[model samples]
Target: MRVAIVTVGDELLAGDTVNTNAAWLGERLTERGVGVERVVTLPDRVGDIARVVNEYRAEYDAVLVTGGLGPTHDDLTMDGVAAAFGREVVESEEALEWLAEAGGYTADDLAEGTADIPRGARMLKNPEGVAPGCVIGSVYVLPGVPAEMKAMFETVAEEFSGEVEHVASVVADEPESALIDRIDELRDRFDVTVGSYPGDSVRVKIQGGEAEAEAAAAWLRERVDLKETGE
Candidate 1:
């Protein structure tokens, strides 16, 4: 499975808030065998978020959108999704009840449209906060707050699970330049991606199915004195 992650927040762009959501999602997605093709960080602009979400949904199998679901004015991720799909924003009864139960605030006490989402969107419960997330089409709209987003994501993470990727790595004392041709050969022969990183030692990462990665590893070991990095 291929996915794109969109993190929305002015604070993240300004460096006031660290953009840990993208990295966390990327790692988790990779662990589930889903390749993250792109990660985008956008300000709380509805049109821009909508455009990206629309584009990514068509380009990738899934689009994981984080941030901008709040009671504040800057919270516009939901609006963006609505715009992208041309769906109307309506109060979500399920979300209203969740908000009331989670925050101990009545629907009337909360800000107007606080529990609203695009029509026909599936409301995703937020175990950690009052504002729940929503899934409008392929785009999963999540909260900007890390704690809430993490909690909300767990409720829907299984939907993204896919085949497990087999990854193996090796480290050689030689520089990456010395292995450029070898890496290309491995890619062609094993049909696996080979990444060469230069440092005090060169680290080559081989990724594909289990058998392919193992074959690539064996090929490298025979050609160069390489130490196994890990599984």
Candidate 2:
């Protein structure tokens, strides 16, 4: 399954907040074998959010949106999603009940549009926070808080699946330049994606199907003096 991740926040665009949510979601989705095609960070504007979500939903199998989901005025993700589908924001009883059970929320808190969701959206229970997320069409909305996002993603992780990629890594004492030719050969010889990073040592990553990745790693090992293996 191919997916796009949309992280919304003005703070992110201004560099005030690091976009850890995008990176975290990317890793989680990759581990589940879902290919993340794009990660976009946008300002907390309903129109921009609606445009991107609408576009990505048509291109990708799913679009996961995080951030801009809260009780505050800047929280516009739900509204954007509703606009994307030409729907209205309505109070969700399921979300209200969940929020009530979660405790610490007064009637005033619930009445603050916290229970409002895009029409026709399926409420996603937030085990870690008061604000609930939802799924409208192929778009899965999530919270900006790292804890809440992680918890909510777990509830729907099973919905996404694709070819499970196997990864093998090896560290070569040689510089990346010295192994460039051999890496090229490995790629040509095996159906695996290879990446070489130059750090204290040249770290080579081989990713693909189990057999292909193993073969590519083994090929690299035979050509270079590997300082370390496995990742």
TM-score versus the correct structure, for each prediction: 0.90, 0.93
Pairs of residues clashing in candidate 1: 67-144
Q: lDDT tens string, model 2, 119-154?
A: 989999999888889998899999998899999999
Task: Point to the candidate with the largest lDDT.
Answer: 2
| Candidate 2 TM-score, C-alpha based | 0.93
Predicted structure with the largest TM-score when compared to the true one: 2
Task: Please identify model 1 stretches exceeding 4 Å from their true place.
Answer: 225-231
Where is the poorest 10-residue window by lDDT in model 1? 221-230
Error of 1 at 97 (Å): 1.1
After best superposition, candidate 1 residue 26: deviation in angstroms?
1.2
